[model samples]
Target: MTGARAMLPLGAALALGLWLWAVRDLPWPGWPLDPQAMTLDQIRMGYGMMPRGVVALLAGAALGLAGAILQVVLRNPVADPTTLGISAGAQLALVLATVAAPDLLGPGRWPIAMAGG
Candidate 1:
């Protein structure tokens, strides 16, 4: 158990490193798929290399932990996050946001969705 605990950071670091390496050289496009193309390097660089990777990993871990907790609390093997209507609440918010103001649906969407849940 302790050995595995020590490997967690190394495992995460390796995963992140691999993801970055794979994406760094792939061809990524903006709004349009085009004949003249740029590699993934160009697309990532254009985004100014913002550190969203940590946030993404953290959010993923949080959701995973939440689902685990919810399943345990609900006392059912199949009680996933969706079983609690969380998924429906999220979908409803997305639909509402799309109808209300599609442009303002980035960060605000989750908060509104969770609130609805």
Candidate 2:
């Protein structure tokens, strides 16, 4: 097997294990949804933090993919978000949106930022 194909499962398993460990102390030996086993705080924290962490992880992965694709497409190792001015342009658009039309960025700032980029 190719190196990446061989390593992907191992990497995914390691990440999953680390993520499970980082979730929180669960009510083991009892039921997962058993309120009597775990406190409300523990439940809230496990549920809340896991989703946020997943979202952050996904976002970072997406950005990494985008950067890699951009570099490959441009045939330049230095062609990243910042070097391509996408980062600066997006920031400028955010600033402009905040100043000129805050409402445009209220619910969905992605299209606006993308347009600006």
Q: Return the clash pairs for model 1, or none.
A: 26-40
Q: Write the per-residue lDDT of candidate 1 for residues 32-104, one digit (tens) a residue.
A: 3443464556556445454576677789999879887887898876888577788888888778878987886
Residue 61 C-alpha lDDT in model 1: 97
Q: lDDT: which candidate is best? A: 2
lDDT score, candidate 2: 0.80
* TM-score for each of the candidates: 0.45, 0.64
Q: Compute the lDDT for candidate 1.
A: 0.72
Q: Among all windows of ten consecutive residues in candidate 2, which has the lowest summed lDDT?
A: 23-32
TM-score of 2: 0.64
Report residue 53 deviation for candidate 2 (angstroms). Answer: 2.6
How far does residue 2 in candidate 2 sit from its true spot (Å)? 12
Question: Which runs of model 2 end up more than 4 angstroms from their true locations?
Answer: 1-31, 34-37
